[model samples]
Target: MKYVFDWEAFGGCLGMLVVLALIPIGAFVVYFIFNAILFILPAIVAGAIILAIPVGLFYAFKEMVFKKVE
Candidate 1:
């Protein structure tokens, strides 16, 4: 008796296994990215606000001091 190997079926099963393996890895990648953005967004916003306040005050004071009365 001789046995025959089916390349097509093997390839299909291999592809399915690879796809299944990637699902968890892809989920973790997305999860980490989302968490990182959430963690960093507040710091970015706080820094922007902190920098803006000083610049805004300087501009406000400049306008008040330099404006001429008509």
Candidate 2:
């Protein structure tokens, strides 16, 4: 007995394969954007904290450490 190939089913499977290939690419782009945002968030928070520390140190020095002896 010989088997027959169904062109319509083959074409549908091909199309589905193409769609499946694209799914990972789309998901990768989305995942990269999300992780990039997550990574940048900590850097932004760290920068803010670092900036505040100097300002606070300067304010404390002026207020308490360096006093006018009059």
Candidate 3:
């Protein structure tokens, strides 16, 4: 009987381990990005709403004044 060390099998196993290790890391990154967007989304929407109110009022007044002028 002869003993043989299979380098190809070892390399394949090592590659699989690396890929498995990266899966959780990739999932965590995706989760963090999603959570950050969720956290910021309300603030972004509120800011837009707050700014829109003033801009809308300004445009309404401008149209009213311009209509009276013409």
Candidate 4:
């Protein structure tokens, strides 16, 4: 019978554990910070466009009726 301890195998197993543990945490962080913003970006742009519409109409009305060139 022979007893042996393999440092390389132990280090590789530890590295794999760290990587596996980090993957889900990394995914969550990326989703919340980056991908989630990307997902909402279209809605944000749409809101800006919606907000601009009323201001545009107001400007158009002012030019048509209030801006009197006499």
In model 4, which range of ten residues has the least summed lDDT?
Answer: 61-70
lDDT of each: 0.55, 0.54, 0.53, 0.54
Candidate 1 or 4, higher lDDT?
1
Task: Write model 3 residue lDDT over 6-38, tens digit each, in one string.
Answer: 566556555754654565455556557777656
Candidate scoring better on TM-score of 1 and 2 = 2
Tens digit of lDDT per residue, candidate 1, span 1-70? 4345456655655575465456555555655778866646555555565566557546654444344444
List clashing residue pairs in candidate 3: none
Which is the better candidate, 3 or 4, if ranked by lDDT?
A: 4
Query: Where in model 4 is the C-alpha error above 4 Å?
Result: 34-70
lDDT of 4 by residue, 9-64 (tens): 55655565465456555555566777776646554555565576567546643344
The reply for model 2, stretches above 4 Å from the true place, is 36-70
Q: In candidate 1, how many Å is residue 42 off?
A: 25
Model 3 misplaced stretches (Cα beyond 4 Å):
1-3, 36-70
Q: Model 2, range 1-70, lDDT digits (tens) per residue?
A: 4345456655655565465456445545655777866556555555565566567556643444333444
What is the alpha-carbon lDDT for the whole of candidate 4? 0.54
TM-scores across all candidates?
0.38, 0.43, 0.41, 0.36
**Model 2 quality (TM-score):** 0.43
